[model samples]
Target: MTPKEYFKQAYRLDKRIDSQVVKLGELRALAGCAQTISYEEKIGSPNRNTEAPFVKVLEKVYLLENHINEQIDKFVDLKYQMADAIETLPNVDLGLVLDYRYLQGMTWEKIAEVMNADVRTIYRWHTKALQLVQMPENPIII
Candidate 1:
C-alpha cells in the first residue's frame, strides 16, 4: 500500500475506534453512577463492607478507562499527523478501501462487494494503502 492509502486506513480505524471509545466512556459513566448508588444504599444498610470492594473495583475500572482514553487520544493525534503527511495524493483510490477496511471495520470480501471488485483487488488496495502510511522502520499499521 502507498503511504497515502495507509494514512487513510489508519484515519478510518481511528474514527471507528473513536466511536467505540465514546460508547465505552458512556458505559464508564453509567458504572460510576451505579457504584455511587450502591454506596449510598450500603451507607444506610449494614453492607458497607460489601460496597467497599466494589468501590475498589470501580477505581480500577476508571483507571483502565483513563488509559484507554489516553490511547485513543494518541491514535487521533496520529491520524491528523498522517493526514497532513499524505495531503498531496489526489488519485488515491485506496481512500475508501482504508475507510471500509479500518474505519468501518468491513471485511475484505465485504469491501469487495461494496466496491464491485474482487477480494484480491481489495486486498491489494489494502496492502497498498498500508505501504503508503507505514511508519519508517516499522511494519505495524497502527
Candidate 2:
C-alpha cells in the first residue's frame, strides 16, 4: 500500500476512535444516571421492598458501563498508535485537513469559508493533501 493511503486510513481510524470515545462518554453518563435513579428508588422504598429489583437493574447497568469503558480504552489506545504513525511523516497539511474535515465534521463549503478560500481551492487542497501523504519525500504543497 502507498504511504499516503496508509496515512489516510490511519486518519480515518483516528476519527472512528474519536467517535467511539464520545459514545463511551454518553454511555457512562447514562449508566451513572441509571445508578443514581436506582439508588433513589431503593432509598425511598422503605422495608427494603425494592431491594431485589434495584439490585438486578443496577447489576445490568454496571455491566453495560464496564463494556463501554473497555471499548473506550481500546479506542483511545488505537488513537495514540495512529497518531504516532502519522507523526513520522513531515506533511502537516494532510493532518490539518483530516482534522478539520473528519474530526470536526465540517463540510467542504464550511472549511472553505473558515480558510477564506474558494470551495474549489479547498477541494484542491484536500486532494493534494491526500496525494502528499502518499509520498512525503516529494510533496506538492497546495
Candidate 3:
C-alpha cells in the first residue's frame, strides 16, 4: 500500500468502529423494547417463538461488540506502528504534521491552527511527510 493509504488505516478503522458502536446501540435499544410482559400463553409450538427475536438481536449485538473490540485493538496497534515509522523521519516538522493529521485525526484547518501556520503550509508539510514516510516492512493491512 502507498504511504498515504497506510497512514489512513487507523482513520478508516476508527470510522468502522464508530459505525459498529452505533449499530450496537440500536440493537441494545431493540433488545430493551423486546422486554415486554406477555399475558397470553402459547398452548403449543407456535408458528414462531416470541423470545427468538430478542435473543437474535442480543446475539448480534454481542458479536458486533466483539468485532468492534477487535477493530479497536487493531487500530491502536496500527497507530503505534505508524508512530514508530513517523519517528524515523529526520524532519521534526514533517513528523509533527503527520502526527497531527494522521494520529490525532485533525483536519487541515485544525492542524494549521494548532501549528500556527497557514493551511497551505500545512498541506505542503503533509505532502512532504507523506513523501518521507517509509511503510512498515510488514504493515498491518486492513
Give me the runs in candidate 3 sitting further than 4 Å from their true place.
35-52
Q: What is the lDDT of residue 101 in candidate 1?
A: 61
Tens digits of per-residue lDDT, candidate 1, 1-142, equal 5455555556565666677677666666666664324334333556545454456656766776777777677676665555444343344667677666655557878899999999998888767766554344442355
* Candidate 1 lDDT (Cα, 0 to 1): 0.62
Full-model lDDT for every candidate:
0.62, 0.57, 0.89
19: Cα error in model 1, Å: 15
Compare the candidates by lDDT and give the number of the best one: 3
Q: Model 1 residue 77 lDDT?
A: 65
Residues 31-53 of candidate 3: C-alpha lDDT, one tens digit per residue: 88846666897577667675655
Number of the candidate with higher lDDT, 2 or 3: 3
Off by over 4 Å in 1: 1-51, 82-90, 130-142
Residue-by-residue lDDT tens digits, candidate 2, 45-72: 4565645434655566567667657655
TM-score for each model:
0.49, 0.50, 0.87
